[model samples]
Target: MTTKLLIGLDGQSSGDRALSFAENLAKLIGTAELLVVYVIEWSPYSFQTPEENAERHKRREEEISTAMERVVTPALARLEAAGIKAQGMVRHGNVADSLDSIAAKQNASQIIVGRSTETGLSKRIFGSSTANLVMGANVPVTVVN
Candidate 1:
């Protein structure tokens, strides 16, 4: 059976590196499919009142969809041009959880993620999402710096 790869893209340089790494791996394992996912981290305090929060959440979802259109749509087009069948998905939740859910839902054999560029105390103070996925995912996870 062909291996399936899921790549977590955060619109950063590290994310680009992860995509390139996944592409190379895909080439080595022919017939594999690629799924690119972006998670929109949702904040609960987006509004003052419950009704306002609902409205704000709806607006934020639309904004996230628009942002994905700007980034993922073109990126997928480029991938298709390079002869890779690619699909993009957006989810709202904790980054690591969203990635794991996608991987499970797609039955992904492998997951590619980018190591956080943050270092030193910052990395320590603010835990890395990639680190969480590396520890949490059920399938094999490859982290690219």
Candidate 2:
């Protein structure tokens, strides 16, 4: 069976570094497939009017569509052009959980994400997604700096 590597991309410089790392690792491992996922942080716990909730589905669809068009597709094309076997996915949810779920579903051998440069109170309170993924992932997790 071919090994799979799942990468979490945030469309940032750190994310680019992570992708570069994953690409090299995939090439090193030989024939491993690459799956790039962009998760738009979203929460469903907000209170809203019935009308607002009624439009939630539509909004979610639009978000996914935009993410696919703006993020995933371009990344996937770049990887493919570099001759890496790759696929992309766009989801709206908690970043760590979404990446972990996708890795599990795809039977990925490893999960890779960029290390956050943010420090201090905010990161300490909210926690970085890479930290959470390392703590929670079932498979091996790699944080690219």
Each model's TM-score? 0.85, 0.91
Instruction: Write out the backbone clash pairs for model 2.
Output: none
lDDT of 2 by residue, 51-74 (tens): 989998898899899988987898
Candidate-wise lDDT, in order: 0.82, 0.89
Model 1 C-alpha lDDT per residue in residues 1-145, reported as the tens digit of each score: 7677998888888888888898878888878889988887765555487687669768877968885897577668767877887889887778888899899989999889888655688469757788888888899999997
Clashing pairs in 1: none
Please report, as a residue range, the 10-residue window in candidate 1 with the lowest summed lDDT: 41-50
Give residue 130's lDDT in candidate 1 (0 to 100): 83
Error of 2 at 89 (Å): 0.7
After superposition, the stretches of candidate 1 with alpha carbons farther than 4 Å from their true spots are 43-48, 118-126
